[model samples]
Target: MNVRHQIKDYIEAQPELKRSDMQELHGIILGIMPDCKLWFLDGRDESGKVVSNPNIGYGVQALKYADGKTREFYQIGMSANTTGISVYIMGIKDKKYLAEKYGKRIGQASVTGYCIKFRALRNIDVDILVDAMRYGVEKTRV
Candidate 1:
């Protein structure tokens, strides 16, 4: 099955959700920022070359922020083992600023260079996340 179909099937199998749940979630994310471009990433694990399991079902958005530059906003793979979803803001230099501002609310914050991991989507503050995404986009602009 294709990545989109797999995602749909996986989400549908969950007990608490209706067919519209995943679509609604996707809509909510896009509604927060209409300019974001969504993408699906599919790849094979290097070590599994002999018996490769093509990993898929990752979602991302490339958005342009106020300063007129674009950056990648990614949510890691979807899986039952995942306690919650993650959104990553990468290539950030001002980790301290973001951590000081949103650390407590974003759930398990970590920073390396410009990469900021917002570990649990359900616990994240959407407004803050939007600001952070905008900030990253602005900061990276040349």
Candidate 2:
């Protein structure tokens, strides 16, 4: 299926509450970066083992490895985990930035190096999450 279809399927497969939350977040991210590149990773390794939760991704960022090889990945990603939803803001140089800048102000969520995880939408400030996403996109502009 197409990227949009794949994303829809992923979101719709979630439980009722998570499905709604993911759908809403999908709309908000699209509104923020309408022209961004969309990605659907099925969360499998090359060997076909499921390594992570399926993700709906937005924007583009090239990541360089130690050997000078690079791979392009999403600037922002959203996934539904066993406990809750995770919003990943990739491409930030400073690992501590997210936790330091938005940890206290973003309500009841775990603000990690590159991820903002929460049990539900009501538990965190969606606006601040949006801001962090935008910042991540800007920082990774190519």
lDDT of each: 0.48, 0.93
lDDT of 2 by residue, 4-106 (tens): 9999889989999999999999999999899999999999999999999989899998988889999999999999998899999998989999999999999
* CA shift of 37, model 2, Å: 0.9
Give lDDT tens digits, candidate 1, residues 1-142. 6645765655566445332434554555555545543444333345544332222222354546789997665532222223333344544655577677666665555533433444344445656666765665555433
Q: Assess candidate 2 and give its lDDT.
A: 0.93
Q: Where does candidate 2 stray beyond 4 Å?
A: none
Write down the TM-score for model 1: 0.47
Q: Which candidate's lDDT is highest? A: 2
Q: How many backbone clashes does candidate 2 have?
A: 0
Pairs in clash, predicted candidate 2 = none
Top TM-score model: 2
Query: What RMSD, rounded to one decimal, does every model reach?
Result: 7.3, 0.8
